[model samples]
Target: MSSIRSPFGQDVEKQGIKLPKKWNDTNSKIPTDRTMAVGGGVAVGGGGVAVSGDSSEFPRKRRQRYVEKDGKCNVHHGNVRETYRYLTDIFTTLVDLKWRFNLLVFTLVYTTTWIFFGLIWWLIAYIRGDLEHTDDGEWTPCVANLNGFVSAFLFSIETETTIGYGYRVITEKCPEGIVLLLVQAILGSIVNAFMVGCMFVKISQPKKRAETLMFSQNAVISMRDNKLCLMFRVGDLRSSHIVEASIRAKLIRSKQTKEGEFIPLNQTDINVGFDTGDDRLFLVSPLIICHEFNESSPFWDISQEQLAREQFEIVVILEGMVEATGMTCQARSSYLDSEVLWGERFTPVLSLEEGFYEVDYDTFHQTYPTPTPTCSAHELAELAKKGEEIPLPPLTPPPIQNPNQNLDGERGRGEWDEEGEVESVSNGDVKKMDVQH
Candidate 1:
């Protein structure tokens, strides 16, 4: 029988109890002399286990020890250390010093410095002309047109901002004005293009750009009389923007033959439109009845399985005028095996709720086989009557003949039939036939 010590440090045994032979030796190292004192010498037993002690003193001391040994403080310190290490690594690795060399800042500084110098030069020229006039008692001292310097300063500001105000005129005669204009114009264009390109790259890098813009993306095959119809729904999740979209679908096929393998197939652009008006923000573009798959059509030879295995991409290109600038967005959905509808057709069923559309296969299949005006009533009736009364043609018996007998009824055929096979005795005697034929 085995026994274990209880949580309260009391030895308990099961049936056929046998005390452990080494129990005393194992427990001998436990301190027994120390006894916790209670109120007025009320004390615990010699064993370290707590007994009836002074309630107030023991509870306070135990609470203090528990607080001192708590694990929460250590966990909090560890988390703080990890956060500090992460921030340090990020700052050290991702910091870019090259941004300080941006051309915009350089251009702005260059324009400001030159403009300040031009203003100073104009002021000095005006002051010199004024002093000369006072000394000579005349207003002329060869101050040539200081207006050119003023125009050059104004042009510098215009070029920096790419505003091209055109209020000030700079002439080739004034070489300083021409030089400043060329430098600022080129610098401004380059900086502006760089900034715009960087912004575009950042916007395109987001994970959402790769995600489909529409939810519930699917395509189905619908029957239209003797032909098959392909239909799908494309909708926008972000409802704020009015999207004008176009969709293009391609049917890809592969064939392997003795000569080689090739993908020979057709691609058709389906109809594109918003079910609602163009002014509406939220839209469900129902692309339906675009192409009819008939016996003569390229899609008739393509099985649904082949279409599903090949990468069938439907790319929707959306363009609109937003904030007075033309903008474009693209969304794509690919075909999966499970999404392909084999030998089935889809019909658009209207939902009572706005912005929702569903394909009704039951109604489509039931009404698809209905005869159209292509067949007249008289013609159909005549065909039906003829079909019912039609009888099978009589079969003719084969003529009895012997394989060994010739047309003259003579037995035993010659060793050669028709003409003897032509044998080419030399390579030069053999003629090459065109394999392509």
Candidate 2:
């Protein structure tokens, strides 16, 4: 038997350990002996038996490889979170105009310069009293030819719109023309200053940016008696500033009348309000119940089928601006008939986060029903006359009849009995019995 030491220096014996005996022969020299197993311990002297550690326990060496840094991953990364953060940053930054002051300043300067130049040219033309011939041969102020006031004004307008119609002509021949050109040059210098001032005012105005107010569009199941109810959400996109906002909704429908073709019916205004909140606002409005479906109203003529096939455009006008310059936002939707169920009401869409909203149709339709018509006096009279002629449907006869009798003769006798029974019973009881039978 043979033995070898392990890496930990433990002596492992392999003497009579059931290794092949021929492998233990001392003189059996062979070149194949060089392939003999070592340290794992079963061995042969010449053509040796081989032995090894448990294959499952084989030691493995780890290798290192390069990984690219281009953001590709083998697992799901929380990318949505990062995207949301980026968007939040953008919105927060854009919610205020302070960051874009440079652009605003440039615009203000540009607009003010033209305005001033136009004003100066008009003043010069008024003072100089230069005259030109018009198509009708009348003398009109030659502001362009003498002082170039017309040219300056035209130039100012052209710069404002950037259209450059190029109609007015100015010459540097006269002192008046030279003076007008100087005025334009001065006007250009101050235009930027005036614009900057205007921009400052605009930024200072109390304007409210659009905000995401409500969580979701949901139905309003309860409301004040005899009133329609609606709900909306609003919010300020900015964190620090407060937005004072008012909301109005209009219910518009197009229908044909006897006088002409399709015309619109606009309901009374529905108003909502919001006070200070953390970038969020809530609003509710009471619908005018008096305008609800009734026989005398246009709503009575509308049907669920018609509504489903047709579209109803609900216009929500939001009145508020970020600075006080009176900015407005509008939301519109075309509702399908299936969406407007139950009665005829609807709920405004809401945002899951900020600046989003949806509509709630189920609640709106569940509350409003189509109106039923009532008979007019003239129609009632006609019906009464028809009833008289019908003769109370000729009293139904008793079942008793001769077997040999024909149906007409039997029916005649039965009518007589039925009439007698009707005369005997009270009118109320007779009607009740008639219904019961």
Candidate 3:
């Protein structure tokens, strides 16, 4: 038998009990297929499936499951169904059953148990010759006026409830009757305690808290005051509020160690409502929880392309006390990469009608396209630091041309005009005679 350590430091046998495995063990071996399931993470190819490139084919293929019902990635593993074989899960089954069904089952079981004990009481009374004769010579039982098994049954009920009706007293003559009465009383108390305890636990479960706690259909990664931040909306569906409400977020990613050991998930806590350093917020209306992608953030270096391809989940947990019931309640939801809408803003879901305030649940899942920077959060911050300044080279002047050296030829002094015509000269100018006109 497998053993588990109890709070008292005792080894308790855990035969036929299946517990969730611890995922962060250092020496655990990882399957080859899970390491390269997504994120192009593994160095060596897994399953010879070409882990580096696209993981899906364009053609229509057989039916397959991508994500599990609990929003976990099913590409590598799925949740285990049955936890325990038989009796250990009885309490769980009872608590999960619907109230109507539980009430019916309790009624049938209680009635059957009461009748069974009553029959035993009647058999003892009949076998002991305890039926008395009335003053009119008619036989009448002491437990009831009727002279049948029902008289003893009614006496059993009265005795089990500790309601003595005087006439049905068990005398010293029937010692076994007294012993049966004691046993019946004890068993009645135990039955009541068991059923009532189970009903109380089922009715007051924390899952009721989630019915009023609403989550937006999609999460958004958008620009908030020029810095990138991831946001999602949450609201209370009922008029009654949750007191001292607080919220938390976690970024869950799969990781592999250098020793080739894989952790199914690695969780990083994110600060919610960091503006005031307090995670508490009034949830009377819809609240938008923000986690900025700062230097220390897990998503600080993530680009838009990488973020789209990354397989990770953002789980939001809200915890608070119900104002009406005065009990602590928690609600949680997870957002996958595909559910994160880029460059979008949530539409307003709260509005004023006449003088009264109203919330439009129809618009709770709605979002509109928004103008956000195309660059990553880190890149945008760096560009903002650079500022908007343009540098130019200084202007220079052009060169001036000289007019002293003319290409036109002039006679040395004057060329002789022999026949009123200019004669040719060695320098392309003939001896020019001064022509006086």
Most lDDT-accurate candidate: 3
Candidate number that wins on lDDT, 2 or 3: 3
lDDT of 2 at 190: 61
Please rank every candidate by TM-score, starting with the best.
3, 1, 2
In model 1, which range of ten residues has the least summed lDDT?
62-71
For model 1, residues 292-405, the per-residue Cα lDDT tens digits are: 454344454454334432323232333332221234544444332233444332323334356765543322211111112222223334555688532212212123243322
Q: Cα deviation in Å at residue 434, candidate 2?
A: 38
Runs of candidate 2 with Cα error greater than 4 angstroms are 1-185, 193-208, 211-244, 264-310, 321-437
Model 1 segments more than 4 A misplaced: 1-186, 193-212, 238-244, 255-290, 302-325, 343-350, 353-437
Tens digits of lDDT, candidate 2, 1-437: 34322222223332232223244556763332132223223232332344445533433211110110111111223325455665566433333457477476466656666667677666655565553333333444434433455566566676445465656545443466567666665665465455555556556544223332221121221122322233332333333332344444455444446886445433434333222222123233222112223233333344323432332333344444343444443222221112233222222222244665433322222221111112222333355568742112223433555433322341111122332332212112322123113
Report lDDT per candidate. 0.37, 0.36, 0.61
Residue-wise C-alpha lDDT for candidate 3, range 1-437, written one tens digit per residue: 44322111223232232223545665674543343223222232332333334323232111111332233334433244655743587766777788898888778767766787778877775664445443344433333343456776777677666787776666555567668877988998888788888888888776676677888766887777767888898989888899988998888766777999767667788877656756796898887788888887888877666664465667888889988788888887776665677766676767778998778787676664444555577777677689842221221111223222111122021122333322222211224323223
Deviation (Å) of 314 in candidate 3: 1.8
Model 1 residue 309 distance off true place after TM-score fit, in angstroms: 8.3
Between candidates 1 and 2, the TM-score winner:
1
Measured against the true structure, the TM-scores of the candidates, in listed sequence, are 0.32, 0.29, 0.64
Q: Best TM-score goes to which candidate?
A: 3
Error of 1 at 354 (Å): 10
